[model samples]
Target: MRGYQEDTPPSSISGDEIAGMDDEEAVFLGYLDEMDELVDDNMEEVTDQEEEDTDMEPPEDLSILVFNKHVGSVFCCDLHPSGKLAVTGGEDDKAFVWSVQTGQIVFECTGHKDSVIFVGFSFDGAYLATADMSGLIKVWKCNLDENQQEPWPIAFEYEAEDLTFGLWHFGARVLICGAVSGDIYVFKIPSGDIKVLQGHNTRVECAKMFKDGVRLVAGYDDGAVKVWDLKTNAVLQQIQANVHDMRVTAIDTHPENNIMASISSDGKVILATSSNGKVVGQLQAENDLETVAFAQDPQLGFFALGTLNGDVGIWDTARQMVRHQCTKSDDESVVGVTKMIWEKDHLITGCLDGAIRVYQGRSGEKVLQLTGHRSEVLDLCFNENENVILTTSDDGTARIYKYEINKDKD
Candidate 1:
């Protein structure tokens, strides 16, 4: 309505003029521009909040370097616990293990026949798992020593036919993968024993370990969320029959509590108990959601949600309301937030705008913005101790950035 030409009416023009003056079709053409304006107006408010929001120490930029070994878009990446190593998998059907400091390729995994969609390191940093779009998963034993260029040999492999997601267990002894057919495969390391979790009616979109690795939480395309007992290899409870009006897009469990947060394509985030599958709280956004994550510190266990329309929200799960909307001060065009994580009092977001932004947790004041990727970032991993992050992008590169944090502050 704001951009419509209200002075010209349909009756004021001749037939030929009417065809050329049809403003209704022209109104639809400006939809994206309207969104850009609205988001820009929203984020403009954050500049005001910056006046009073000093809870977070300002972030410092240490480095921004790119890895260009992959010939195709990098789909996934993971940082080891030690913060010294990183792994990335990409569309080129190859996975690369690299040093986070120098961005040097440590080892190249080149056996997958299709695009590698997921790559993760075990909690102990002793193993790495790489999975392709075709459901072939390979586990490698990271043999890094003083050389740092040591070969990582393939220890085992599994095929699930339609792999969607995968991760290493907390102990680094279990490998779990979700399939397009709505089944989950749990592989015991070294032993090669497997357990299959079946309950979801369609594809499994996301899955996470909970209860100190005793249980697993999974979300599906049909909007169902389930918690499984890993020891028994059975679903323990159904967290939600319809967590969202549409497919579940992402999920994140609490750092210390038994609750987990789930988001769907319909723009809703639900916080529920993992043990009994009870709904505790919910938050809604104007745009469909892309990802959600909980902060690691239990005392400040706020959660963050990223939307498809490029908005970011920091919610107080205990209060059941958003504390800050990062885009409320939009000074530029918005882009979808594809990945996000919360560390202490800060939130790190990987945006489809091909930029990585760090915001103060409580006020949503952007502290730092890192730009290097030529396309949307597909994955992100942060190492709090080292103040480093590894990000993979659709532009066929994995990048490493070092953030300088104020250690003197509490």
Candidate 2:
């Protein structure tokens, strides 16, 4: 077996000081002991605007502030493709579906035996999937009757030990995941049929669906990326090209082309063709890279890469040069970037410091900075069609924000 083990820090806890502890101890001490101060710090500081409105009311700065739901830190969040609903999963072992406008809990998912590590929405928004650290996945019908009761009935269930990441096909018919045992599992919707594709020797860090959903691009903790064919459950290509020196952190597929972009913990980005696993371009960075994203609009012709030292770079894909870069100011402390997304002419990023910052896509200038979480920001999603953003953090909260256009400025 490849020697690499899956050691990325859990979203429920943060800090390199406690990185050596087992999962159980880390979750307990990090959330219980470390967060005792956080609960007080987060609860006591109310803005003057909030005080004027009411002690318990949400301040005017946010569209919705969800509270009193998760007892532990939130680990992940996703928006429905329809953009009207959102789901969040966390250390509380519960997942919640809520309205974007009202913040009312539409349904509560309560069957997990451990922390819900990831929550995802189907591409068509017809189904919602939640997976826990215990390697259990539960799927729920998203279009259930509005009056449906809590503890939503599961439409499908699958068990695989140490499931790390999951995503749906473009048609929302098949669910795929990577496991710590280096196995890939694909379960078809409504049907219980299961297929296993085995190739990677170490823990799988990330996976992406490409080639009209007939192929999967998987990255492993051993710094290997392989493409698998869904039809025959066979390995289509093994990349013999430039490989990451460290664990592969993230992967993003091109919206129009057959290229896939990936980043490693060693601060390098590689653009490779999906068909043959041939390296097309590589961008080297001065800091360790953590996450990456490709611009959906073909005309943009650029990709975004985020680093451990609070740096964001927009590299021109054609020219293979850094077109723009954004870094923390002198007054701001450096924090690792955890996730990134590209929207209309803007870049949205989540950081280890529990802050979300928006920068201009072309100029790399700071457009907006938001802070509310008491710990690291774990995951985030943006729906351009609805102009809404959802962020989940270790502070045990998921927030919804809308991008407002200033009509007066135009």
Candidate 3:
């Protein structure tokens, strides 16, 4: 057996030494120094605050209901159609269906061997689907008969290549999932009938269904966007790969128009016709885009884009210009947005800084900021009426917030 020997520690490189290095090496050293300083500053701030408020309690106004059953980071969450219940999945490989009003677990979805990355309710609240990172998917029948004594029975289950995202059809029991194997799987619930939509050997990063319910638009990691005819499992149209230089972060379609908008981490936004995938308009951003959402009303003629640098822009689709630059709250740190939705004339966003913020879509003003989680918000969703907002976070809790527009701000 060979004897183990400890390697000598490297001497610290000085600023002068870094300056004399090549451009790439000097830049790398500078990034390291900046990161070190940032860590030191955050540590100092946290230590000081801990010492100052050792016995303080958090305010009760943070959330209306908090679901703390998850043992690890909650990765995904969805609100029930009735707005009375919610389903959340977490890193602990479990999913919980809980009451929103009282924060009581209604169903505990178990038997997963990996982190549950996605959980959603079917359109009519008839079924709940939970998908894990290892491609295990389970669908449980909801709203069971009151006389039944057993737990909710599993309606459907399947295994596929590692899953990236999953979504339920708006009007049907169909469920669609994207996989790392560059395939989109559509499963009709209970029956487990499968339809495979083949992709161009690249991971499907995100997808959205057209309002017509027959067409689906999918964005790929290699910067391709394809519109698929779900009925035939054929590609109806596709945008060229050169349109975006990097992975598509998010995508949304206009409610009334035949237009689809997709944003990339490379700071590019492409607006294309969903019918033909023709490139109609494009916008460039200064920072990497994280999320995108279109106004529900076609008359608004605008969409919102959230960036990784903590900036939000409301773009006028017709005029191809920024209409309003929404600002964050003054007290918030520069934690980027992770998800967003447009409800009526307002935009609700979930941030990495563990805050749910509401902005006025018409005037681009920050209206509300709700906080509770101590870590990043991973996912969020709202009810049909937009009155109940549910968010899951890395803090191992899911929070429910009641939302109401402040007419006084108008």
Candidate 4:
């Protein structure tokens, strides 16, 4: 019988030296050698993977034009009806009308006592309105002549009580504004005439003009929704406060029908008729709701909703159910959605993570992500032709991205 070495360890004995040991000891030493080789191979692979990951770069900035003049957070932005210019208001208490083609400042709207909360162009692109949080509203007549170098004249001005939001009529020279005091003011631009619609002592959170251009829908902080007659200054219909149970965040009217959709901060979505204010449908989400938008085409019979939890749900109006849910990647943190709009078959969303995501409206899959802003997106609007998007952010900047249809998705 062969004697075995008692003091030496298997790892210290090499395969060449194992021949002098007992058969059992030699086999154990051989196994140890093989295990050492396997560990070395794994370490090499891991080191190479780490190096590759370290070399990866962040996504490129996709904005075609960046507006960096605002000294503070940009609160609102709009594209001109002719798609030749853009207007943005910010916490800097200033508003700028800049050319889209050259990004040159066409006019600087100043003299606001507080932050400019809203800015937009009129339906015909002849008037531009800028409003501040302290209720200072100024309307400017846009001079489109390329040879004209003078500043646009102030056509109208008014001071209300703590204004919250403003809207422009789609077909007329009417500018509607909502106030914290629950009063909705309608102003006929250039004339400075005003009509006041009283609310039930709750702040008017959001409002929209109907396609007919005669009626308006306003949502309140107490969860009440009212359809008001612009001509009569009377409530045409009302949805009582018990339905939403929270502050209304947004409201949108259908393009070709009497249906209106309103979302509340408590995650309740109410679909009602703009004519009678009758509750036609309702959807409840598990997270707080932030924004909602109806498809541009009425034939699609669906609308998209955004949540504070980074969820996008495309709901079928006829079925009263979610057709598809768009979610973020697993590696991504929760990114709240602040605003959204539908253009043709696409859903464009502005997120708190500072990304503008474009989703395929038919499949609910994200097709493109545009990045540039360093803070939350406050608002967004697209050109009349839907080939460009203008977005404002809390980062004190606004950016424009060219919208190209991804034909591969079709």
lDDT of each: 0.81, 0.78, 0.86, 0.87
Pick the winner on lDDT between candidates 3 and 4: 4
Which scores better on lDDT, 2 or 4? 4
Q: Candidate 4 lDDT, tens digit per residue, 295-361?
A: 9788888898898788888999878888888874324566779999988888989999789888888
Error of 2 at 366 (Å): 2.1
Off by over 4 Å in 3: 1-61, 144-149, 328-334, 384-386, 405-410
The sequence of per-residue lDDT tens digits that candidate 2 reaches over residues 173-290 is 7888888988988988868589998854688989887747688888888778888889899988766644777788888888764788877877778788887889888778755778
State every prediction's TM-score relative to the real structure.
Answer: 0.81, 0.79, 0.85, 0.83
Which residue pairs in candidate 3 collide? none
How well does candidate 3 score on lDDT at residue 405?
A: 48
**Which ten contiguous residues of candidate 1 have the minimum total lDDT?**
54-63
> What's model 1's TM-score?
0.81
Q: How far out, in Å, is residue 301 in model 2?
A: 0.8
Residues 1-410, model 1: lDDT tens digits = 14447777654434476467568865754685698798778666675567556564433423466788998789999988888888889889999888887888888887898999988888888788999989999999887784755567788888778788888887758999999999999998767899988754699999888748788888888888888888898888886565566888888899875789988877777889877889988767655678888887888758888887888988887887888889777787887888997777888899886788888886778887887776788999888767787888888888888776443121
For model 1, state the Cα shift of residue 182 in Å.
0.9
Per-residue CA lDDT of candidate 3, range 228-280, in tens? 99999999989865998888878888887499999898899999987778899
